[model samples]
Every structure is written in structure tokens, then in C-alpha cells.
Target: METTKWLLDPAHSELTFKIKHLMISNVSGAFKNFSAKAETEGMDFSKANINLTAEMNSISTNNEQRDAHLRNSDFFEVEKFPQLKFTSTQIEQTDDESFNLHGNLTMKGITKPVKLTMEFNGIMKDPYGQEKAGFLVSGKINRSDWGINMNVALETGGLMLGEDVRIQCEVQFVRQGINVPVEV
Candidate 1:
């Protein structure tokens, strides 16, 4: 029943995100090189530590020119910072299968409090009897807050690349040891 110390099943996990682009719509993207780590014991999911790292240059939004510009000094400036990291400051349960993931998200030399609205999508076993847990984490961040401001003015109205960015993560993790039954 220990929900603590559960390893992040890298093979089935993902670190994805989306950002507001112009006042018209949003541009979705993700970090190709990223990892999620967590420590859990049992039904008690409190005080667990979680960390996630993303490679700076691996940012993508399906467009080559825009993606290249984002890597430049006006945006992420991948050459200088080189990494986006998040470390848990505090984690507590909101319900049986959900928690409030509070962490310090550091990017481009700016450290800010980010709350990842987390949902524990339950645990299950495969045909091989390996226990697995799934989670969907989401949060919003201001691009200008991290000094990533590079926008253009439209002939009709507002500038390109909106300030608020909505990020979401759909991650799945597999337990490495013991076939323990989850209580909550």
C-alpha cells in the first residue's frame, strides 16, 4: 500500500506543453528530452518529492522558422540557460487520487512558484503483472515573467505571441518493484 518511492516509468512518460501565440490562438509544443522523478510510499501521497528537467534546445512547435527563433537570445536563449528545471517545494493530497504539486520552476534565470494541478489517474497492472500509475499535470505560466518576450505587431490589431502560456503533461509511470495493492 506504499505510494511512496515509486519510480517514474520513463518509457511511458511524457513532458509536453503549450503556449499562447498571438491573440488568435495557442501554439502547442513539448520537450523531447525530459524526465520526471517521484518518491511515494503508500496511500499517503503527502510530502513526496518530484523533479522534472527539460533540455532547452529541444523545444518544438512543429514550425521550423518559429522554433529556430525561440532558441535565439530573444526567447529561451538556449546557449545561456540550457535547461528548464522544476523541483518540488511541497506536495499534498487534494483527494484520494489527486494532489497539489507546488514546485519552483526555474527558466532563463527566473525562479517562480508554479502549481501543477495534478490528477492521479489510478494504478493498474499489465499482462506481465507490472503495476502502473498515470497522471495528468497542468499549469499556466506567463512568458514575459521569464523574459521570453519576442513578439510582432499585427496590421489589424494586437501583437503576436501572447503572454500567458498553458502547459499540460500526460504522464504514465510503472512501478519497478513489488505488486502492491493501492488502498485509495
Candidate 2:
């Protein structure tokens, strides 16, 4: 069997997360520098092996000071662990278009199991004659599970940040081959 390689189209992909802040509101952020790649036997991405990486220092929450603190020792510790990575270990097709992606997520020098629910939005040929595929991914993980416990209590009798973080990504992939669809 021949495998096809797919590379992420950074301009068409986004990695974002939301966490509770001040015990009342949610703070959203994104990682500006990230990359992903996948290898599969064909257009059937249900069994694709996916690998992704994001630069910890590229985290942006729209606030310079908060972003800086997130990269500091209390949070991501970018100087010591600069990259967050995920590599798929197993992928199960829950339906024709939906899948459960089981993978190992590494952050701040710790690796943990993670499962992402993904929706495969099908493949298409752009006007430029490029073959592209789209996917919507979502998952949640506890920040403390990765040693990111920056516990700061507020005067209002609650914590400053939430423990669980919601992660979401919209990724578009460009096939390495021509516009022709691969046979599974």
C-alpha cells in the first residue's frame, strides 16, 4: 500500500483555547506558531498518523503581560520547555465523518493521554487545483495535569484561572500529490 503525505496549511488552520478567568469570564488565546503533518494510506484519514507541534512562546491572549506570564515558570515555562506536541496513537471512526483521536500530548516536559473528537469535513479541489482536506477538532485537558498549576487566589474567594481548558482547532491540509484523489 502506498501512503499519502499531508501537510497543514498554516494560513487556513487555527489552534485556540478557552479557560475560565476571574471565576466568571472566559479568556481565549491562540498559538501563532504551529505545524502539523499526517500520513495515510489514502483519502481514508480515519487511520492517519498525525503529529503536531506548537511553540509555547507564541501563545497570545491579546494581553502582553498575561502572555508573558504564561510563558514564564509559573505556566508554560517556555525557556525550559518551548514546544507542545501531540502525536496520534490510535484513531477510531465513530461514524463515516466523525472520529475519536487518541493521542499523547506533551507539554512542559510531561506527556499525557488525550482524546480529541474530530469531524472530517471532506476533501475538495480548490480553484487553484490543489487538493485540500478540512477537519474540526475539539478536546479538553486539565492544566494542572501538565504541571501548569499557577494557582493564584483572588480576593473574591476563588481562583484566578480555571483548571480545565477547552481546546479547539480548525485545520486544513494540503495533499502532497496532485489534484487527483487517492484511492483507499
Candidate 3:
């Protein structure tokens, strides 16, 4: 078996997150700049070496003021911590399509273990003759764990923002280097 490297197709991949706001509704946002890679032996990605990084300054929530605030010390503090990163330590296959991806996530200079449930969406050959792999990833983490401890209390009683942030990713990887047939 030979190892093949994979690069993320940024145009076809997205990293998004959601958090409860005002204790009533959820606010959705996405990072506009991010990249990931994987090195795999054949097509069974369970043992792949995966890494991901996202630019904290590229966060977008549709509102410029809020986006700026998120980049400040109250949240990500992009000036001091410019990137959020994840490196997979283990991949546990739960089924043909499902997996538990164990990794360490670094945000705002804090690194913590996180497990993301992922679904392999299979592979395909695009019209451009490139082999592509798809995946759906989801996870949750407490914002406070990353040192983001800024929030206000609502006049009605509840807090301004939820502590738990739900992350979702629709990612696609394009095969790089020499093409090698994966054995069954």
C-alpha cells in the first residue's frame, strides 16, 4: 500500500458554526478562510493523518459589527490568536459511513480534545478527472473552554449568548500527488 496526500478544495468546503443568542434564537456563522489536508494509505480513511486550520479573522456572521467583535479579545482575539486548528489523533469507524474522529482543537491559544462525528460521503471522479472525497462533520464545544468569556445577562433573566457552540463542516478533499489505486 502507498500513501496518498489530499488537499482541501476550499471552494467546495465550508466550516460553519452556530450558537444560541438572546437565549431564544441561534446565530449562524462561517469562516471564510480555512484549509485542511489528509494523508491516507489507500481509501480506508480510518487511519489517515488529518489536519485543519481556520483563520479567526475570516469569521462572518452577516453583521460587520458582530464579526469585528468576535475577532476582538472578547472572543477569538484574532490579534493574539490568529488561527483555530485541529489535528486528528484517532479515527474510529462506527459503520461503513460513520466515524468518531478524535482530535485536539486549538482556539485562542487553548488546546483541548474534541471528538467530531463524521460521515464519509464517499468518493467520485469529477468532470475534470480529479478524484474527490466528501465528508460531513459535526461537533460541539463550550465557548468558555477556549477562554471566550464575554457575555451579558438579558434583562428578562437568561444570558446573552449560549456557552455551547455547535460546529458543522461540509468538506471536500481533492486527491494530490500521484494517483494510486486503492485495493479492496
Q: What lDDT would each prediction earn against the true structure?
A: 0.79, 0.93, 0.93
Give the C-alpha miss distance for residue 85 in model 2, angstroms.
0.3
How would you encode candidate 2's per-residue C-alpha lDDT over 112-143 as one tens digit per residue?
99999999999998777778899999999999
Q: What is the Cα root-mean-square deviation between model 1 and the actual structure?
A: 4.2
Taking all chains together, each candidate's TM-score versus the true structure is 0.86, 0.95, 0.95
Misplaced by over 4 Å in model 2 are: 179-184
Which one wins by lDDT: 1 or 3? 3
Best by TM-score: 3
> Candidate 2, after superposition: displacement of residue 181 in Å?
17
When summed lDDT is taken over every stretch of 10 residues in candidate 1, the lowest stretch is 175-184
**How does model 3 score by TM-score?**
0.95
Q: Write the per-residue lDDT of candidate 3 for residues 15-54, one digit (tens) a residue.
A: 9999999988999999999999999998779899999999
Q: Considering summed lDDT, which 10 consecutive residues are worst modelled in model 3?
A: 175-184
Q: Which pairs of residues collide in model 1?
A: 2-41, 2-42, 3-40, 3-41, 3-42, 4-40, 4-41, 4-42, 5-40, 22-161
Total colliding residue pairs, candidate 3: 0
CA error at residue 172 for candidate 2, angstroms: 0.2
49-96 per-residue lDDT for model 1 (tens digits): 778888989988888897798899989989999999999999878888
